[model samples]
Target: MKPRFPIPLLVPLLLSVALAADDDFSFDFITHGPMLGEVTDSTVKVWARSQRPGEYAVRYGTDPASLDQVSAPLKTTIEHDNTGWVTLTGLKPETTYHYQVYHDTLPTGPAGGFRTLPNAEEHREPEHNPRGLFNFSFQFGSCANQNPNHGIGPSLPTHATMRRTLPGKALFSIMNGDFIYEEHRTLPVTNWLSQVGLTPGESPEIVKLAPSVVGLWENYKTYLSRGVNLAAWQRNMPTVFTFDDHELVNDIRGAGTTGFRERRAVFRDIGIRAWEDYAGWACPRATSQGIHFGTAKLEEGSDILTDKDADFSKIDLAQAANLHVHWGTDSAGVDDIRLDAESPANPNAGVYDVLEVLDAHRLRVTPAAVADSTGSYSIGRRSHGKFTVSNCDFFLLDCKTHRQMHDPKEPGKKGLTLLGDRQKAWLLEEMEKSGADFFFVVSSVNFMIPHNGAGGHEFAEGKDEAWTSMLDERERLIDAFDALRKPVFILTADLHNSFAIKITDRVWEFASGPLNSVNHVPKNDEGDRPATGLFRSGPRTCDIRWSSYILPDLERLQRLYPYYCVAQINNVFNMPKELGGTRWVAYPNPQVIFQYFDGRTGAFQYAEAIGTERKP
Candidate 1:
């Protein structure tokens, strides 16, 4: 019966368009989004914002009132504040237009839709790079703390139970990190900034923002003028994101290359400019001070973990002594590098001024070759890339940006990385150029053993940010997935206890958490608290299997619709295991239990597949 998402008529249509007051002059709405970013094969990119400004455009085609196609204007001001980001270009692939969003000729909101990406000859058929069928399904989740007390505002009853279970054209959703909780919107949000007029105790202006300014775009414009569940789940699909570490804080750290560049540009330029001004996210070549300006050399000397591919030079610091190199670049398209240090007096000290959050923005140093002298540092940009959908191919790994703070003079470790040597030689050279029989690795962090320094956020050796605080890049990403014996499967969600763990026995490590934040359950160091599969204290919305990849008819992936659960703890013998792998604890008292439901209704809460090695 999953139907309840009127949210009292979507909270007065998103509060009359974020408290509109154009009075009647038209445009005073859609101050947040129309969202739907990065789609190709003829291009698509709409994402709105214009409660005030003027001229903007994105009319769109495929006819809707003979919608004579458009595209030009885009004037929304505030220097990127009145946000617009238009890009309609040609258009065709899997096609499905019918859009809206104007301010000049009038027509403010309503009338939205999008669909692109499906033209490599409609994702190839007729045996083109053939292999089993699996069409598509990405539907990911992550921490969202819109603070409905502590969380769950845009988690929207599981975004209306994933929009009534992936209905009509649904193959795109990957918000792999804290959507908001924007470091408490950087303090001082006094009396709701006086109900939008300011003065109750005033201090707003995002508390004098700037450290690069990403106050969650003012905390998602006050969580979408007070919640409409992430503008009704990003105006009906087409979402792609990444930003662990509470968007900015609560575990924030991504420096190296001698870090401290103005304190790593304060949170890497206001947390990637508040996630590219609230998810318009397009920073690979990002500049205008947001940062991602590449440059890292030293390969012949080898060692940035060796995802080889270097060019930019100039650092001969005493003829590149101590050797041990490897540093790469190619961000706008992805193939980053870093890790393995030494031979640096200032071998470009190895660029720490990058952001968005690791996959190695920049952090270098790696000498070792003569009794290893200090030689260790792994900062980030090792994220490599890949993202097909319907036929399957999701490889985006770079967990824990760039790290520092160590002490391993040979306790089974030296200078390894979670993925930074040009993302482990671009993930074993893109898994020998995968052909996709079904693969996965969209990690942002999480191999298991939860306790990211728990309420203390450690590193000095307390580690725990996922992947055992860097067990030399987690055993070199588990020997590069046990030498890519194929059979790939490892989707992650920052440990809110989304479940399915066990790191070996063939690699399994599924999870989902904070998908919308504030569920904390992590306490250890003697405090103890982690094991709690299928969680949901408040930021409701759960799953690690989520219909084993959000259905789309794989024989209806064991149906479970109408389910809108809210932290339904079934305690499969106190589920959420991995007690010895490191720290994924949680079954402390689970005595006798085994619960699993296929179809849900009584408030819906059943994604019981706990991190997967299977045994629900």
Candidate 2:
């Protein structure tokens, strides 16, 4: 197949980076990344892919000159897409460490550095230790669709803007999905005029299908190699990832893509495998084994798994529980109780031999209490997770993997779910127990504010992609968040424009626009219109305090300025008692400032401060 975009210029440009004299190591150098992954107190994972099969290592230290530490050389193979991670361990906490990737004795790319988060030992009561609660910011955005043949350019200017604007201040970035739109060899008729300067097969980049990993790897490399800004930012900052639909297929569900229902399992398995090798390895997961069991309950004294909304057909029975199964709490803090299902003794409450999958929804297993039996019912892996830095906690939800196909007709269906059972339970439990002052929940899709109108608007005919589709589950999750009473900010993307909706007194949803994709303006009948209490979805029944969009008009929307959001936690501000009052007092209240910046010009566009209450 043809290359996704014209990349002939990129080939020699990347090839020139390997300056070492050795023919074996110099020629086969780093292709895509030195992308920083999870940066803990004492360790950091650096992900890189070679141009070909080779061994690589990371040389690092707090001082760039000395560079004493070196990671164990990891080999990159075509089987794993020639990508591997080199973890630098035994580093000091809260210290900045500079590092460079090496193909044997040769330097692959320019040196990049990242600062580790404060250690757990540094966390203490603010009253006892003044410096215990540290303040920091993080950059986040989604839908960096790099379909170069389309109207969008190969250069992801947003990434460059994010790196230059935020510099080294932002702790990390959360690339909440749609990192790549795996659509190759497809172009629009309108975009045909834009392809005049490009030649077919101009670059050596090949698109191979069958194995799926090859094409996906090519897709990542195509995008990464095309954009210098994206590659540069990735190399410098540590990024946590959670995928949306595009990583697998456009608007994919658990069942499958609408037309290709038969290939659901293959798509999910291959998509996730490629994602794991490229993205998921960076952050840890709460449930990293199989798909978390959904609709777990005791029906008439029998343990039954009936998730009517989910498509169990997508489960790979081969690499499933039969190989190995683990049960217990969904918390990332606790170790899962591993059970050998292949054992003849059937020690796992008779789960080895007689585990019956009735259909897409219903399954029969050994009878047990609902709380005691929390394991994956299908082939699910690391999709959702919980992580913490200083005083802020993060919950990254996997919106696509366990998602049910949303029906526009029945918006309030009983079983329609966005986050499946075990994940929801874990999120609620973790939120309740969290001691952090701020919570940043990463949901790749939008939380509320239905993009499609509720009534019979022409544009709203079959749209049910956002939280509006799963009203019941969304409300329940919101209520759980409301009960926390702390400042909970839901960071979301997938929508092509940036907006913020104050969902409740303590809960807010801040969605950033696409990093490089076209800026999509919602229709006239779409989004929340504050003038009337009614929105496109319905009456604004929820306690939404305020709502605002960065590009509210078509004129500004046409500018196509890429966007990203930065949330500054534990910020202080002064405010007045009355509306637009001059007699102001020092608020000194702990707050989170949601700041938006234009990805093209790096200009600060908007800012909103939440959590101004005097007490926690």
lDDT of each: 0.46, 0.63
TM-score of each: 0.30, 0.72
State the number of backbone clashes in model 2.
3
In candidate 2, what are the lDDT values of residues 1-616, reduced to their tens digit?
9766469976765676654334554346787788999877788889888766678889998889877788998677655667888778898987888998886677886788888876645543334334355557888988886655322567787887777777657878899888887643132212322222223332211111122334555567777788777889888899889887667655444332121122222245446656777888787787546433333333445545565665666665432422112222111111111211122211221122116677877665543322433332223454688888766789988787556666778778777677766677788899999887778899988877664532232222366567877888888888888888788899987766677777778888888877877655455324544522334433225443333343345453253657888988763222335768422122255678888887788888788888644654
lDDT digits (tens) for residues 170-223 of candidate 1 = 546667766666433433334334323345444323233331242445666766
Best by TM-score: 2
Model 2 ranges off by over 4 Å? 1-23, 26-28, 119-131, 148-152, 185-210, 256-266, 290-378, 453-461, 524-559, 571-589, 612-616
lDDT of the structure predicted as candidate 2: 0.63
